[model samples]
Target: DKYTGQPLHNAVVWLDLRTTELAKELAKEGGQDRFRHVTGLPISTYFSAVKLLWLMRNDPAVAGAIREGRAMFGTIDTWLLWKMSGGHSAGGVHATDVTNASRTMLMDLKSCEWHEQTCKELGIPPEILPEIRSCSEVFG
Candidate 1:
């Protein structure tokens, strides 16, 4: 099952390209030169992070999958990369772009990495998480 449920109805899925543009504009407007390296997209509620959380709370299967690490969670691009790279489970590339990671409300924006504190605050386990990566990269 693809897990297409009604809760997903009318939900907005933000794309990385669009998010990157918005981040660029926001940085420019704020006159923050450091924003140059703030590549990728800006965080938004439409991303999978929020949805994933919702699912974990309301859907038992998703929660169980997460706990068991049987399911791989990530944005569209990450899913694509995983599939394209031979889907190797052992040492498989489980990762997310910074933009997508930002949307999860789980990563520390400054560090571009998963925030253990944030995970604890959100009641999510940090152990089964994927690594956050730069937006521009050549996937294996």
Candidate 2:
């Protein structure tokens, strides 16, 4: 979290299986097409959104931080940017490049924007996600 400069939960790796059942449940709701139309990806635990949702449901510290507005979710690129830029001092830039953002299963494949409806369905707070930036742009 930005407030504490400490991670709310242990870093959930890409292969983590904690979100497997959640992914299956999400898939049952509308299958991969539900997400593929906008995100060009399937509803799977391999993505960031599902992992974050797992934290939201299973980790009290993470959930509380998110509810209290201290959480700042991002992929590895964003974390590097935030820390390299300023990181809780001066001015940390919470942002990620298009490639990284797109893989989160949250960004719209066409508009390159966060898909709000998908976020709501997964109980993900929009604010937790970082600003999406072009890969070639100056991040800091």
Best by lDDT: 2
In TM-score terms, candidate 1 sits at: 0.60
Each model's TM-score?
A: 0.60, 0.96
Per-residue CA lDDT of model 1 for 9-106, tens digit only, reads 22336542334443344345444332223323233434454455555676686677666656556666666666566455434466778777776656
Candidate 1: Cα lDDT at 56:
64
Q: Indicate the worst ten consecutive residues by lDDT in candidate 1.
A: 1-10
Q: Flag regions of model 2 displaced more than 4 Å.
A: none
Error of 1 at 65 (Å): 1.5
Q: List the residue pairs that clash in candidate 2.
A: none
